[model samples]
Target: MKKIIVVAGLLLTMGFHASAEGYQVNLQSTKQAGMAHVGAALKLGAESMHFNPAGLSFMKENISLSAGASAVFTDLEYSKDGYKHNSDNPIGTPFYLYAGFKIYDNLAAGVSVNTPYGSSIDWGVNWAGSRLVQDITLKSFSIQPTISYRPFEKLSLGAGLMFMYGNFSLSRVLIPAGDLESLRPFAAAVPSLGQTLDNFKDIDAASATLSGDAGVKVGFNIGAMYDITDKITVGVSYRSKVKMRVPEGHAEMNYANETELKQMIATVNPLLIAYKKNPIVIPPLDKGTFSAELPLPSNLNVAVSYQATDRLLLSGEVQFVGWSAYKALNVQFSQEVLNGYSINAPKNYENTRIYRLGGQFAATERLDLRLGAYLDESPVPGEFLNPETPSMNKMGLSTGLSFRPLERLSVDLAFTYVTGFGRDGSYPYVSNDQVKAFGGHYDVKALNPSFGISYAF
Candidate 1:
């Protein structure tokens, strides 16, 4: 049963990728809680290592450590013509860890392990759209070690080396049997219908293959922060994109009968069967590479904080993400095995900009509370929204609290609500220019809540 489930999961992953909107995963960390408080580290503690490594320059402690986790919920639905289907993904948990220290009077260094990208979708096998894409699983994790220097009392510079690892699995079903009859007329037109039939049979037996891959990559980030005054600050950073390659992978096909397929080939023109075997068996076996050139989108952040009677702080920021550079998923394979299977993603995707505003209040000498909101634009077009990575414009609302039971120990907890623009699209089963079947639009949605703890030594 487990093997069957695994195979089914693999098949679902393939179908989803065939229709995915972007090759990138959407696993942004909850570290944004600290980002909400512009002075979180410049005047507070170590969470700055993630919000802006440059903020580490303001750390006064010899050592600081922080860890946290979040529970995410996603709901999706689809509609087309007069039919509709929906899927609600179970709550998922993602985590993060960060450690930093003041190395010298003007310098600081830190390290972090966080899940920057990942998501999973599982639609029931009986759903009408399941044949198109039943499930999708993708994970992107990174370890970044950084250094920061305060050149002046009001300015800081930072840089980090990043090591990233990722994995992807997608699946769907391809009905080659249903397509054979549609090609009968074309096959009959060829003179040798028997030979043509043999070729078609081989293709059908090999048409659908379960595919998956895994890989590793590395990159870097550089940033700067400037304190314009006691109440305002700004930051700029660039993350270099990294490329990952899947060295070896596996592919499988759902065959009704291995014995019958062999017998049919022996009785028919075996040469034609052998010639067509390459397209079916060997083609899916090729070691294809999945390279993700995830350039760290350049970001510009300007933040302002005002002190209301030295107890409450209000802050807001505007950010821009250089997403336009993320234009395609360039796939490459060995020429000997995959002569015609390489594909380049379509080029309609564009970069996105985000706006964020929030405030924090120090209700007590030892307690801090925060609230924030942000609007994020969608990078995907309507035509590309699919079961895998179904992306849309997103809006978020968040609330968090920090407690200081001791002078050196602090605990922070946060909750966030993320919603996406509902979308519609279609998937068609086509091989050799003929459509055998089709599935209509579907919908999805998500929510996330998180918590963290920090200690200073």
Candidate 2:
């Protein structure tokens, strides 16, 4: 049928842009009251373009906007001793939008649209680890354009440019038997009639698919504030590290009953080519085109702040993430019968450090209150836990509230919580007589919630 509709439109254009390893879902946005205070204001405003665009040079005088949403919950488990499985995923819905503006007098600008990363898992295909993975969904979105500058009075600088979008889906199944392919024998082998066969061969595919490519990222932020008198005031900021690239697409491989396995490999390729003329490793029904490559790693932030009165405020922060440049997964096949099948996916991912503390209280003149805490560390390790991406080590909690009622109008709310402490890995399967099956060990847990709102003109 037109070659199965042009191979299903090239597997939907190879799903668009591939670059997924697993465990990513931060959602970005909801620091209402700056998570209690620690955000310290990288210059403060336009949501500081996601935490620091020199805080948009402390934008003032008309122009500001914000919106938010978040919800994520996950709990996955796999066991042995008679086999048992569990999965619960649903609570994902991240939404956001931001805007800020100010021109001349020191310049300032902003823009944002978020959903940092995403995830979803579904398991149970008859258990027994179902080959290791049953279902997985991923998403990433970002849009940032910012600028800030303040020549004097205490320094301030900012810049940004980010545009990203991603999506993915997965599924699996493969089986082979028949006495392991009749113990490979065509003539020599007669030890009283060697025997062992059960007859079996089934290879199903499609766990996830979708890809699109794009790249060009950059970030910078620097801030300083000092007034060690008149009641003391000090602040510092530095944020940089953003490099992303995702290019390559087009993939389609749908073969199951593909015309009765292409007429049983054209009747067993001329009877195995006259009983072994060497030119038949079980071939037939071969189609092509496949590609994938993704790398977007970099992060660093440091902060410290103190107001201590006039409504109270205090903050602290430190964050760094490099993720060992994500190990491997370079697969490019256009027929060579699957040349050099690469899929290492091991970088032992590390380079992680996160700590934050906050507090803010106004309680009058219009009301305001906030509180925060965080500690996250886990660059996936535990034998490279896999199920697409199952990471661990996390703890966070935050609360916020703000209101002005009028005077340009203002209202904001925030909430956050994350927890995950479970680990174990190993999942690799490849069979078609090319034998290779190893799938066992798994456990995971996660949760998140956030909200936001702001307006001034």
Candidate 3:
């Protein structure tokens, strides 16, 4: 029975990495995203509150407000063992809002609301790999209140308080026929396992699902921006890691179908009877609660902005993600029979560096055009890659335009296309304490379009 508990989580992790940034989302600003997120040292209206709070000190107005939304279309394909399969096309919607004010001659304050991490994956209930994952969804959002101070001209410093909330859910199937290791230890008592081991085939015991909600988590960030020359500006920022946990949530477990299950039981019962051993008794799958915890990676960003001409601005940026701090995922369940039932998987994710370049051209006093590109690195090594996310090093192209139709109002629009190189990987199915292997390959692509409007008063 204990071994059965271990086999229950075979594919529980299949849905862990749907969002980019290794489950982190980077589309907080459509304008910045359109510029491949290269505006660390550039003035970006009120939206700058989220990217670099210190930028607020450069605002041209006493009060500013901005809002935007993004739509993402994604496709993921897999091929293995001469079989080609793909997950359902997943669509993600992310949005953000920002407000800033010049509180004093040298001080600025602002607030931001945004979806920082989120995405959903569906593998269809009857797909070849359905046994591993049916559906998985992750949603996360954050609120930040920031303040910036310019103690001296040309230099600004800022800080913010972060509050976050998230939700997670994962579903998969359980195999009844225990793998060799799971049954081997109990083989002495259940003589039938040894007698009919070769005759038994792995079949569904039940459909299992776990869902949890994150309690409020807190973290902080700080930034510095300085003007080196009349046309050059540099900025650096850091966001600390957030530790989050789902206190206690619900789990659903039950037989999805009964015809085949009854037949399998009938086949094994007589064998146990003849061996004078207790007949195999499948227990009812009970619904209960569970707990889980995960850590949000820390981030460091740096960039330099250059005014190449009177109407042209260029910027280059670098960002480092501390994914190595993510070591494992732990889940604990509540139930007498599953009293200590838990699942823990090692991630061993690595830190990654991202490069971005962008330029903005002022076509007219009220019209601006932006162009940018970026190369993003995946933190998961090939050997550790899993179906949960088909993440790979990616190259992205983006463009956007900002128009001021009214004296105090500006509207922004942006678009981006991102794709990954093919990646192949295999996952080990664990039974008892031993592992068996399976192989597969994955290819993924995404298209995102965004809209925004801002007002300066």
Candidate 4:
């Protein structure tokens, strides 16, 4: 039971990493996303609240509103030892809404609601790696109220209070049907147990489902934007790390061969009693609960925008992700059978960087065109990679356009394509008190289409 409980925690911890690396959603603004999600140095009115709040104070409108959503279609494949598996992931929808108003000559205020981190990966119920992770879905959002102040005509500063909430549900195999062969030796020593175990040769494996809701956590986003010249601007921003805690979570167990399992336990008790060994006990699923803590890493961005001509603008940015803060995860279960057991798993993630470049051209009075590209690095080491979150370095290409149907209203559309550099990695852990490992070649790719509308007056 102890070994079973520990493997459960091991799988849960691996599932949490799905929110980082290539899985972080970056579809806040359709107009910005057209440019590979680079906008820290641009004056984007209400949309600036997400890229860089400092740009809000430079808005030309008294009121601004922007809302948009994207559909993420992802594909993942894994191959190992002549076995191939593909993820049947559902389409992920990430959206954003921002509203800002000019409070005074040099002051601006706004609020933003967005889904910034999420992922859905399903490798089916009986994949080759089902023991590690069969499926996982993570959802999270943040609401921020921001304030921007332009103390000087050429300089602006801003800050926002971030309230974040998240939740996840995952399922994994606890004991595979094939692993039951280990009991063959014990069964041979006890004829009654052997007879009972023979009836379970074709039974389904044991599995578990874990679900949890994290409490609201607080963080901050701060930024500065400066006009270096009439045609050039520079900006920097920092988003603080948020620590999310699950006070109480639920865990449910499913045993396909319950009857046969109980019979074997009953039959083997006498042999254990003669050897003075403790009797085996199974915990009740209805009363099982757990607690865990996870972290959303910090972000640092530096960007610059250049206006080359009256109708053309170019922007570039560098983003540093502080994934190193995610050093470990601790999970505790409230089950009498566990004997106060806890699992502390180490996740030695490394910091990573993203480089972005984008260009926007005003083709006509009512139309604008944009194109962008970015490179995102993977934070996970090769040896630590797992199927739950098979991460690798990726490249993104994007294009978008904005059409003004009315003087104060604009319709935006953007498309982004992501391709990962295929990778091969492995993860090792203890299963049934024995050291084991899982490894394979992985490939990932995705397409995102975004639609949005912005109004200002």
Per-model TM-score, in order, reads: 0.76, 0.33, 0.88, 0.92
Error of 3 at 58 (Å): 1.4
Error of 3 at 91 (Å): 1.4
For model 2 the local lDDT of residue 371 reads 79
Q: Output the lDDT of residue 168, model 1.
A: 59
Q: After best superposition, candidate 4 residue 117: deviation in angstroms?
A: 1.2
Give the lDDT of residue 360 in candidate 3: 88
Evaluate model 1: give its TM-score.
0.76
Model 3 Cα lDDT, one tens digit per residue, 293-319: 888888899999999999999999998
Model 1 lowest lDDT segment of ten: 1-10
- Flag the better candidate by TM-score, 1 or 3: 3
Writing each residue's lDDT as its tens digit, candidate 4 over 138-226 gives 88999999999999999999999999999988887766555555456666577676655556555445678788999999999999999
lDDT per residue, candidate 1, 340-402, as tens digits? 554555534666766667777788988987887777776666555556546667677778888
**Candidate number with the higher TM-score (2 or 3):** 3
RMSD values for the candidates in order, in angstroms, are: 7.1, 15.9, 4.8, 2.9
Identify the runs in model 4 with alpha carbons over 4 angstroms from their true place: 1-7, 10-12, 17-23, 184-204, 264-286
What's the C-alpha lDDT at position 83 in model 3? 90
C-alpha lDDT values of all predictions: 0.57, 0.53, 0.76, 0.83
**Weakest lDDT window of 10 consecutive positions for candidate 3:** 176-185
